[model samples]
Target: MKSLDIMIVDTPYCFAPEKLRKLLKWFFLAYIQTLT
Candidate 1:
């Protein structure tokens, strides 16, 4: 999770789509909550 945070922060613009990154971040947290 810490690595993921760093990835999100340091990843360059051309490497990933900003909107998808944000959507994935939201879904990742929601999925974790659903598991517990």
Candidate 2:
């Protein structure tokens, strides 16, 4: 439980929303390109 809490605490630093959104946008474009 403590380890899980630590992981949760650590996650935000690794998964910042701005970075995640940018990556998601790139991935979405790449995925759309593949479908066409």
Candidate 3:
């Protein structure tokens, strides 16, 4: 779980669709909650 958090934090900038970025950010926040 710690590794997953690190991976998300270490990800590079994205140039994809804006909608996709928003979705990923939401999921990422949920994931971090689990770690806490």
Per-residue alpha-carbon lDDT of candidate 1 for residues 1-36, written as tens digits (9 for 90 to 100):
666567556766366688977776786687678679
Name the candidate that leads on TM-score. Answer: 3
Model 2 residue 34 CA deviation (Å) reads 0.4
Clashing pairs in 1: none
Candidate 2 lDDT over 1-36, as tens digits, reads: 355446445555456688775665675576668679
Q: What are the per-model numbers of colliding residue pairs?
A: 0, 0, 0
Give lDDT per model, in order. 0.69, 0.60, 0.72
lDDT of 3 by residue, 1-36 (tens): 677667666665386478867876887889878879
Q: What is the full ranking by lDDT, best candidate first?
A: 3, 1, 2
RMSD of 3: 2.7
Q: Estimate TM-scores for all models.
A: 0.51, 0.51, 0.60
User: Which 10 consecutive positions of candidate 3 have the poorest summed lDDT?
Assistant: 7-16
Best by lDDT: 3
Candidate 2: misplaced stretches above 4 Å? 1-16
